[model samples]
Target: MLRNSKSGYGWIAITFHWTMALLIIGMLSLGLYMHQLPQTEPATFQLFQLHKSIGFVVLTLAVLRLFWRLINPSPRLPDGMPPLEKAAAHLGHAGLYALIFALPVTGWFMVSASPWGIPTILFNVLPVPHLHVPAALGSQEEAESFFKLLHEYGAYLLIALITVHVAAALKHHFISRDDTLNRMISAAPGKTDN
Candidate 1:
């Protein structure tokens, strides 16, 4: 199933959800791990490059996933939910989506604004150029510091949001006893319902 149905997610959405989940979680873990390592080590530099590569990949995937969501309808929230709860759910989801895009863009901006002039070679293969910043942003140092803070704090926000998302899903599945989680994990056999 390529498109989403009224009841459940299609293959594409499910794939995007799981793949991006893994990548985002992995990226967050990597970031925390790298923070503890001595920056002068060669391995630390390599890890930073790898982190940048994954950030770009996440950005690309986020673009596609968002496009898909724009075109396809998402599975509806449980019918029994209260109006206030539903609104909260929607707002929470909005936050999640916002972080998804903001984190990567901020990371890219941070790297581009760095004074070191380090070229971002994606996966050490493809050369990703830095963003050409106008003088209006002041010195590169200030801009880099600004974006770096955004990226770092954005990561922490993402983690907190993900916790809420997962808890809500589990609540829907276990407490609510609905097919909410199941529908996302797998569609009914021969089901066109996304």
Candidate 2:
């Protein structure tokens, strides 16, 4: 059950999918909460550091997940699914992967461009190098603003995609009475017939 079959996902894929989903949700919530904290609050800096550490972890996992996906093809969609639905599923997955990658990179850039010049100490242990931004980009404030916008807006889009993804999975499971969601949720041994 460690390797994927045509009808269902393997343990590895299920683990990666659920783990990343939880981490992404946690990161989004943490980001929103941290933003609301007053700058002078003692917890604000700690929250930012934690957020950055988690973001780095997400980025690393995203890369590994992408590699795993390339090497191991996904389970086939339930039979009778429309071609358009299949295409949407593919594009939605691609967008999720793209956001997973882009969010961290943009966050790194935003921190690097920050006029405050705070060092990104991963987990308060290792220092992560910052992305180098050209000085010709007007000013540090301008660069930070640009990256901030990208990071914030990208998060909104990711949330929307996740919402749709969840709704579609639910629809497949309930309305369609398909095995789409169960395939990822369960790993019980069974024939490759859905």
The sequence of per-residue lDDT tens digits that candidate 2 reaches over residues 73-117 is: 678887698999999998999999999999999999999999999
Q: Over the stretch 10-128, how does candidate 1's per-residue lDDT look in tens digits?
A: 88998999999999999999999998999999999999999999999999999999999999987777778899989989999899889989998898888899998889999989998
Q: What value of lDDT does candidate 2 attain over all alpha carbons?
A: 0.91
Residue-pair clashes, model 1: 3
lDDT on C-alpha atoms for all candidate structures:
0.88, 0.91
The runs of at least 3 residues in candidate 1 whose Cα sits more than 4 Å from the true structure, single-residue gaps closed, are 189-194
Best by TM-score: 2
Instruction: Report lDDT (Cα) of residue 190, candidate 1.
Output: 29
